[model samples]
Target: MAMAAPAMRMASSASFLPRLLPPTVFSTARAQFLVRQLSLPLFPNFNIAIPVGISLGLPSLPEVLEGIWEGILKAVPKKKTSHMKKRHRQMAGKALKDVTALCVCPACGGMKRMHYVCPTCASTHPADIFSLAPTPSTLISSSGSSSLRIHDTTSPTYPLAQTITNAHKLGCHHLATARGPQTGNIFASVGFGGDVKIWRQNPDSKEYELQWDLPTVSDAGKGDVWAIALSADENFLACTTSDGRIHVWDLAAKEKIQTYETGGGRGAAGGGGSFAMAVDLSRDGRLTASGHENGGVYVFNNDAGRMVYSLSGLAKPVRAVAFSPGCKRLAAAGNAGIIALYDMEHGEHVGNLSAPGNRPSWITSLDWNDTGDYLLSGQLDGKVKVWDVARGACVATHSETDSALWCVRWLPPTERALGPGMGKGERFCAAGASRSLSFYREATGI
Candidate 1:
């Protein structure tokens, strides 16, 4: 009776305990099996059967609980995450994205992404074209070096056609070439050694030969010759002097023709020292213009053999002066960065083109395209800007290098096909301290 009572009580206790658990994990079948196992004898009698896990000495209930408690202890938090560590995790997804930048090329009229070159044209130069002169087949470039490199303008590659070794004994700083309808195959180079020498292509050898030299003692001495220009006929040469005198020589006769003096030249007492730095003869061989260190620009009439217009408004050293193809307008700029436009007919200050509210480096060189439509200016910041004459607006800007650009010039118009969608617009070249020549084609080209 006592055994029956204890078994009945144990059975009641087991049944009641199962009711306390949720039914999902421990179903009715599982509760019944667990109760059957719990009702078994604590120890085995003789030859009694035991479950395989118990006979194999599997872990006891208390030992299993102790292992679980140890696992929980191992999972405890170690340390707080740092702010920087959290930030890195947060930014991981947002950091993976492409940055697309775009730029419209001034020369090719092609739209391209920034930080890339034009896909159509491949132009390069060995040295800066300190003074660029157009020729029949290529461009003659002179830098601070003695070698004069001729670049083929017809091909997009701008291959080097000829190199005049030791063209200037002391390194040529300026080069001038003219092969227009009125001019023959003649070019001029002025060197730092203080001498001027004219060259012509030898018909038989197809190489340039020294044709003439200027008298000097010293060429780089008092009233030193600073800049030179040649007329379309190649018969007249104009050069600037430190004393602010522009001397014209008849190249054919090798005689001094006329000298245009700025009233502010060193010859005048209390007159601001005039240092003529740049000179250019009109394409028609009618006018001569010179820029001076005294911020003065002078236009001289070739036929009249006198000064015509003395332009102002620069108030700073004028580094570059250029005339329009039609000989009607003149463009001048220099240390002031503001490009001053003047009328050759009325000799009046017509307009000015400048970037407002921005710090500008010195304007080193200027060239007017053959069409007289766009004016290209290269600055010390290694940036080239194309200014529209009609609208007086900066149309395109190329910022390729951070070095100073010494010169820039427009290439002659050509109908030759370079590549698809290329060769339709005006093209120009720029060179400077970077020692690499860069050519940009106007998107207007075919």
Candidate 2:
């Protein structure tokens, strides 16, 4: 009995020894494995930030080795995880863009993701775009569901304050908002169904109330309204039709005032007629310019009711046209991937503004700042450029997206402030084939 007890005690002791030995072996193996993993990649040269895993492991090294490293190099205190979130919030606050969201595409029935084209519909028009009124508080935009929307920019997130649905039976194509305190809130929009509607914000209701709607064509055929423009005082509304005819309407009397033709009522597709691809009203309300699919540009005098200038310059379809805030110069861009600036007073062509190493991508849009000092341009290749008009050079370049740009505009400086730093609050909106609106602000220019 005594021998058996001793043997049992020996067996129990032997089993305890095996358990202790395994723990030591297992710990060694784990330590070796972790060291190998750390040695594999010290750090990646990621531009924005470091990976999270490496940041955590950096503090767990042995203290003895830390002293040896401290003598050879200085160590920066590791960044706290909470600090990352705080820094990001700071950046977003200073960003020129505040609110960005996609407008659901009526054609494709989907959202336009960044850079990627629409997956469902083949149409290329931007989903929703806000045409900021010359005034600071008002904005107008087009939607995919045959609707036109207007927003109040005073809100921090720029919420949609009004929506005009069924404005166009087919769909609304473009929107234009007038400048000035009194005229700023009043705007006009044209739809695919050949109708132009005018909206005014009712002071009593604080809502956009439909003041007038003009049916451009007799029959609501497929060939409908193509483009629209509103004069500075919001008195005269100019609209172009698919039949290549320009119709001018007087809002004060609610009557068709005049009609201008482009010689032939034939447009690009021969649907109704191609009168104009794009149009714009001069800041002074004296001159009106129209771009045609055949790459023709014409400026007419509203008072004279006659074509004053048949500009001979660009040969490709013109997509965008703008008059400098001063009304001295006209800038136009289109499929040729070039912007042609015209001296309206002299009735002569000014020099073209294009970069020397510039690629031959389609120049889809052009906009001049209020002072006419800088011009903002967007292209089909997803490049945004700010041009110095006096120097005739590109001062800054911003790449927003690759989709074709439909429109670009400089947010006018506010009444409270003007100059470089005053624009800290200035933001511009861009919309195009991407079915979304993008906001950008000038990075602090030293």
| Most accurate candidate by lDDT | 1
Q: Estimate each model's TM-score.
A: 0.70, 0.66
What would the per-residue lDDT of candidate 2 be over residues 272-319, giving only the tens digit for each residue?
345577888897888888888878888888889988988878888888
lDDT, residue 341, model 2: 90
Task: At residue 267, give the lDDT of candidate 2.
Answer: 55
lDDT per residue as tens, model 1, 1-446: 95676657665755565464422332344444555566555312212233333322123445457758988998998999898877797689634444456666555677754433444443333455577777756778787777887777666556566888888766777777653643438988888877888998888876678899887564333466779888877888898877787889898999888978687653332343488889999988899999988788999898998988888889999999999889889999999988999999899999999976577789999888877888999998999999999999999999877798998888776667754556566678787887767777767666
Q: What is the lDDT of residue 72 in candidate 2?
A: 59
Clash number for candidate 1: 10
Model 2: per-residue Cα lDDT at residue 230: 85
